[model samples]
Target: MSPTLVFGVIAAYFILLLVISYFTSRKADNNTFFTADKQSPWFLVAFGMVGATLSGVTFISVPGEVGNTNWTYLQFVMGNMVGYAVIALVLIPLFYRLKLVSIYEYLRDRFGQNSYLSGASFFLISQTIGASFRLFLAALVLQLAFFDAFGIPFYVTVLTNIALIWLYTFRGGIKTIVWTDTLQTTFLLLAVVVSIIMIINHLDLSVPQVFTVVTESDLSTIFEWDWRSGQNFFKTFLAGIFITIAMNGLDQNIMQKNLTISNTGDAQKNILWFSITFFIATVLFLSLGVLLYEYATTQGIALPGRSDELYPMLALNHFGAVAGIVFLLGIIAAAFSSADSALTALTTSFCVDILGLKRKEHKNQNRTRMLVHIGFTILMFFVIIIFSSLNDSSVVSAVFKVAGFTYGPLLGLFAFGLLSKRTVNDKFVPFVVILSPVISIILDYNSEAWLNGYKFGFEILIVNAAITCLGLFLLKGNGKNERLNEAENL
Candidate 1:
């Protein structure tokens, strides 16, 4: 737990990433950056996505929540499996058939320019907030556990964090991230497995004994049938389905990697495989949570005021140097795995969705992408600072809540486009997308009083999409779409 030792671990890790970037990005161009030249292997994408999908939020936040919510988050993961299946069967083929780089371009082709920008705008905003939140947790940890010991301010820690991500990602973009993510996922999974082993050894329990201790405890509660509660099984399951559809299916950040596969079949395989591995990873984290609490109670450790701080507090201070190393490795790997690709995807989204970089001369595209990449890095630094001041709840909750509002319009826009034959009035498309989430906020705030003590949970995403769908339906037009089902001839 020495500050000097923590700095050495981080420096060594960043150097490894830079070395990987050097090899992967040697001849990378805009195609390489945006689409990885459509040559990524399906299995690598599948394994790597486990890290990106869970990210720092699950790495630190999910395990800490066992004391508060138990294993009910598993219900959400179950819903994710169903959601990923839908994406593989339906959304993947459609995206591949269309040959998309930025997924929001589908909006422009289907509903006209107005809808396209609106969809892309939502992605930019949501991803900025989400990535900032993830990176903020990692920075805050480094600041408290290491940097503060050296008299470094919080802002310097954040700047260094963003700078490292930008260093490795500015050139190869998604191509670099795909390879780096695979490596990071390996380290992340290893960290958790080793940490569990360390805990059980300290407690003098065998694998079977530990498993029984975790599963038989109250912390293992995974289902809630009370319909009024936010953690109700049905609500969590449904929310999982919709959130995956929005965050994974429609998201440029997640889909950007899938699009790197050369064919529809391979991309679909990547997604289906990712779903299975993601489920296993979540269960491991939850079990780690159960053990963490057990260890704390048995050792007479005082719990941190915030659930999110419990794991770090124990790992760094009480669990020995090896445990501290494992926790730091798990979190930084988790943070960079998601945040790096997010930078590339945000750059891709802005360049293609709003700036029309694709339509410009090929010579200039890479320059614009590089600039936009830098712009987003700076934006994340400021946003992370802002979030540091205001974040009061567990980060996992904050991220999903933000997604419920921002990603909802994307779900509504895509659903209406594919399900209906009639076109939308393009000029009014933006308004409908904007208004839907506002209505959702009003309803969610009043749901308890209006519905006899019922509270809204992740299902707010479903309601937000439904409201947008109704508004879009009211503005339906006479034109029919022809471009969607047919693959464009390159």
Candidate 2:
């Protein structure tokens, strides 16, 4: 594809997002900034979340994974369904009953002020690093595809791209994000669908032939029953539930949008729709990978070392100008949809939870809040550049390793709140939560060294969760009535 056409399509796509932002941000205020006045349609949120859920990581990563990982990632995606169902039935009702602007506020009510901060702080660290790294990855790929020709420095490219996101999101917060995410997701889904059809025709394979090749090619098998392995069936399903509960049900970034819908019932319905749509959409992308691989095998193209680049590289080289353009659009749609929302959620959580901006009723709250929003956006700009420059695959994996620690404490905090009644020693709560992960990290690192051949994967989440639950037990005061201790008699 010509650089002119690729750049033109991408520019037009950004303009479309800006238009959505403009309409949504008009007359935006504290209520709109925080929760969209609890008036956003649940169906819109359900559809919008599809984009946020996939993000740039899944957009490029999952399809590529099909080629390299033999399509076992679908097991995790299927596990996500069970996770979402649990979120709808249990977490949504609790958040609704509390009338929470920041979901972490429940931590204070259930445990103490320190617990609240502990939860939010973990979220800020994890989301900031995770979002910035995701943006950096997408920016690097975009730079390779488009800006390398013009000799544009990667940092300049990163700044310009993130600046565009901040431009639209600085006003409306979650209100604007809900609508923009939906629009971006629509474009993203359309791009994927179009690419699939084009690739199928290009390969001259009928639908049955495509499925036959994929099923026969050793990439479509789903079950791995080995408990010790990374992609094991039970581990994937259980990890799916835990990850969904911790990441989606507990984290402010995702749940904030879930809270924006009108009521508990609406939010619950939206969760259901979001799960079903997300699963189907993921399957579509994975199938696209199957087709792409089949086409590459027929054509004999060289694959990149990192599986993540397979989709873009193939589209640029083999699928010609039209598919190349579609590929770029899909990447932009996927990257911005999640990146923009992450920025908004970061702003929302900071302004509301950590900063206590949401509790204020001052007329100046809007002005002050805008400053906070812009400040974080700028912070993210530099953070993304630093992470992009490091570019070490294991270094990125380490960030995820540290970030994984946050989820266990989160899961323990919520589970203790809902499932137990003991009054926790507020002073020791932070120590317990913080120490659990640090201890787990030490143990996890030494396990392989001491045991000689022990390995870990997503199971780290399970171990972290267990340590958190243990910490909670240690913090409970003796002779205190369990929070649920009295309820069982009812």
Candidate 3:
């Protein structure tokens, strides 16, 4: 895989995305950019979301994870399925009935100005870090595959990647992302399927034999019965539920695509479809991990220091140019599918939630939105560079660890709003939201020593949310019905 050839493939991919953006953005207005004017096809949204949901982290980290965690991630996937059902049945209808551009507006309607700002602020912090983490993986891969070969610095590679995403996405936003993500998802899946076949053929194993090998291998372990281990089935499964509820159901980035559909019924259909497809996709990636580890053992290949490096090492160095090209395209597709939407969602949240772009009759609203869009792109660039310098673990773990703390506050806020009728003293929310994650970090750091060797995994999200919920409850106002009536009137 020549650096020039990899660069050429990436250029071709970007051209395709730009072509889609051109068509989608023509005659586009704020409405189209925000909600696709509520006309997106359910199936297209479903397909595109598969790519966005997986991102580059899953492309590389999920398979690599099998070396250590085996199939315990499947427990999380099952929880995700349950969470999606909850989103389709519970959250989507609420958003549609409310006619929300930014879902945080729900916090405003149910609570007050301070609550709304707190929710939006949490999303800004969470998404900035989350999106940057995903892009960090993508940028690192690009640096290894191309930039390093050219003696280019890593920050330059990060900027180049962000610039390309901004180039295609600055105009149309979610309208452009809906179609482009569908195409990217296709390539992302193709890369996985092709890589599997290549690995199987190289190992001289039949399809059934590949399955048999994986089943017989130690990496096939999926259930962890230990009560204290972080990967224990119940802990991981429950964490997955809250994580999906918070990260997908509550987060603006995933829900923005769902909200693009014309009606509640279609949105439900999109979520259900995406849920099933995402489960199957997880199985495929996990299966590929089994094969990769099996191939390494049988061929006596020295595995990399980091498990995350295994997929790329094999694909680029050993699996021939075709596999290398597929790997490059797959990662780029996976990375852009998620990154483009995050950029759009960050801009959308800032303009609609923070800046109140919709309320004001500004003549230059579109221009203002573009500047916000560019501002988030630059923010992601710096965040990725920061993450690259500081990260020390598998990216999949890092992403979920951060999510548990950041998204936990979101989960608590939404739960408190939906399940309880009481409103909190809105002004206290920012303090509570900030404090929850700080407490979670302290507990996470001392979990093993304090809990007598009980380690916290993704389930720490549940703890973080519980702490936030407790704080909000203590701040609860006495006039429950009054706030409920006010929300209804709003």
Candidate 4:
């Protein structure tokens, strides 16, 4: 592939996103920005969610992961299904009853102001770092692919990419995110399909043969059966269920989309369908990883040093120019789908939850909202730059680790309110909330050193949840107000 051609295709793709941004942002006010006036189609939200669920990390990491753990990550997919089911059945009802602009508001209503702020604060921390890391991964590729001229630093690349995401997402918020995510998901899946076909042709493998090769090969195993092993089937399955419930079902970014539905029933349906489709999509990506490994082995080509680059480099090397262009577009789609949504959700949550900016405020309210958007954009810019500068090999691991602690507190706060009849002492709640993650992090760090390789993985969320429950138990608000508080809880 000529550099000029690759450059042109990538440039043209981003230009299209900018054009979509312009159209989506034009008529967007706070209502349109945050919830799309509650007019967004549930089906579109589900469709677009496919892309958002699988970011650049999945795009690159899944195929690479095939080589490492015998494709055991599929166990986590089962866990995801369980998670989504809990979200649809349990969490959605609570969220709908609250009629919330920010899901965290339910915490305050049920528990107290401290619990509310605690949940929102944790979201701000988790999404900021998680989103930044996603952009950081994409920026590294873009820098290596296009901006390696004159020795431009990776930090500059990270900042530049985040700025672009902010520019488009700032105006329309969730309104633009819904439509843009749908388009991005389309591109991402198309890229995957095209790449799979190209790889199959290159391998001279029929569809059955492709499956045959994958199944007969070492990469198709689903269960480790070893209790202590990473990616053990049962553990991954249970973890997936909890993760979806805790992370997506309860978290603001994903539930924000669900809440955009006109009614609870429709939102529930959307989540059900999204979970089913999400599981199918995970299988497809894993299959692609298996095929890529087969293709590389047949051609006697050494895989890239970093497993993360397996699919990208394979497309570039074997399928040549056309596939390379497709790969770049897919990467952009995969990266922006989540990045734009993350930025928008963060802005929406901050304005309404933290700053008390009402979605139904006066016309001049746009100024405050826009400032909030810009503030988050700037924050994303700096965070990505710092992440890229550090160039941590375990960036994704770190991102999920943060989620385990931060989102567990979110889950705990929500559960404490939903399942219990007690009102948390508002003043002490914040300290408990703050201490949960700090304690989880400390435990996570020391646990591995003291207990050997028995470090926390996804199950650390369980620990965080337990600590939060313990904190809630310590609070003994008067029973006289319990019924009233529980009634108002989200």
Q: Is candidate 2 or candidate 4 better by TM-score?
A: 4
Candidate with more favorable, higher TM-score: 3 or 4:
3
Compose the digit string of candidate 1's lDDT tens values, residues 214-333: 989999999999999999999999999999999999999999999999999999989988999999999999999999999999999988989999888888887789888878988899
RMSD of 1: 1.8
- Shift in Å, residue 414, candidate 4: 1.0
The Cα error of candidate 3 at residue 244, in Å, is 0.4
Clash pairs detected, candidate 1: none
Q: 75, model 4: CA deviation in Å?
A: 1.2
Instruction: Report the error of model 2 at residue 113, Å.
Output: 0.8
Which ten-residue region of model 2 has the weakest summed lDDT? Answer: 481-490
Model 2 ranges off by over 4 Å: 359-363, 394-402, 449-452, 478-490
Worst 10 residues of 1 by lDDT: 481-490
Clash pairs, model 4 backbone: 79-240, 79-241, 80-240, 82-241, 83-241
The per-prediction tally of clashing pairs is 0, 4, 0, 5
True-structure lDDT of candidate 3? 0.91
lDDT of 4 by residue, 361-474 (tens): 476788888887888888988888777667545443556666788788877887777777766567788777778878888887788577766645677787788798888789
In model 4, which runs have C-alpha deviations exceeding 4 angstroms? Answer: 391-396, 448-455, 482-490
Q: Give per-residue CA lDDT, model 2, range 107-181, as digits (tens).
A: 877667788888888788777887887777668767877788899998888988898988888877788889988
